[model samples]
Target: MLIKYLGHAAFLIRNVEGIRIITDPYSPTQGIHYKPIDENADIVTVSHEHWDHNAVDLVGGNPVVIRKEGERSVRGITITGIPTFHDKEGGKERGENTVFVFDIDGLRLCHLGDLGHKLNKEQISLIGRVDICLIPVGGYFTIDVKEAKEVIESLNPKVVIPMHFKTSSLDFPIAGVEDFLKGTERVKRLGSSEYEIEKDKSPLEREVIVLKPAKSS
Candidate 1:
């Protein structure tokens, strides 16, 4: 699959069947937005109701938003939604969020949407095994660097991609990417805004991938 990190939580994923799935298209800043190469997609997934993380209108093409825990099939991808609390104890300002699992070919890809707090034992169990995890590391309304470490440990994903941290847009005053990697070691910082992953190769035993945000328009 081809995964492109479009800043914040937005990403464009092209699955095994040549279907594109975009996740959480939001404005770059509070008032400004970015341009997408392929604005249209076969499917779109939103984690919660946050204004930035749920900008469905900015995206082009026919997209469907997964509002709750359920399963949906678009083209050949098997998308499953697991309900999760937005905050540590489900008492955060935004209420709840949806963690989506994209099963394309043999890869199990998980995207954690606007996750405000750490996942509980029960929530982790429901996540199952994930090959690639797209997680948010911003502090104001999501898990910060320290808490993100705990969450990643419990999830035990083969590959972890950090997102939603500080960028050019400081609409939300949060920490930068450095905050997320302060205590971690040997993290791979890819300079590209997009990455391509195939199922043939062996997954990373333990790795944190830092990618550049897609150049906004």
Candidate 2:
């Protein structure tokens, strides 16, 4: 399987069979209307209803979308939607968020889309073990660097990819990439949008892997 981080929370995962699954396809200036690129894929997994995370229609394909509050299987992926609040205490502000835990190729992956606050013990128990975590470190609407550190500790994922931050297009005044990389022992930039996360290997300690945005069409 190949994991490609497409800026923000967007991701493109391709299996050995050449089937592709896209997660949170968000592009500031290259969708069907806003962003011109076609996000068409075999399956599209959305973590929440946020504009940035639920732009599934922009992908331009009638892909099966998984959301709401249930466990649904799509294409060969076992998707479990764990209900979560968008904020610290029972979503007193921005509403609710859906955390997706997908099991594919014998690997379990979790994508915390626009997660606003730190999770508690109950929330942690729901997620279980995660092989990879696509996390947010943008702060204003999500977890910051410090909070992310705690999330990492609780989840203990084999691979962690930071997302939701300032880009050349995203106008929101969120923290930049440096804030996530600051003091991180190992932050390596993967040249392209794709990579492979293996569990047998050792993590770079407290390192974070920064992936470049996919080439806009």
lDDT of 2: 0.76
Cα RMSD of all models vs. native, in order, equals: 2.0, 2.8
Residue 69's lDDT within candidate 2 is 56
Worst 10 residues of 1 by lDDT: 29-38
Q: Pick the candidate with the highest lDDT.
A: 1
* Candidate 2 accuracy as TM-score: 0.88
**lDDT (CA) per prediction:** 0.79, 0.76
Q: Can you list the residue pairs that collide in candidate 2?
A: 29-35, 30-35, 30-36, 31-35, 31-36
Measured against the true structure, the TM-scores of the candidates, in listed sequence, are 0.91, 0.88
Q: Per the 3 Å backbone cut-off, how many clashing residue pairs does candidate 1 have?
A: 0
Worst 10 residues of 2 by lDDT: 28-37
- Which residue pairs clash in candidate 1? none
Candidate 2, residues 1-217, lDDT tens digits: the string is 6887776778888766666788877645432122433657888877667676777877755778777757877777778878887777677888888888878777788888878888889889988888888898888878888998889889998778887777665667788878888877667787776788554554646456787766333
Best by the TM-score measure? 1
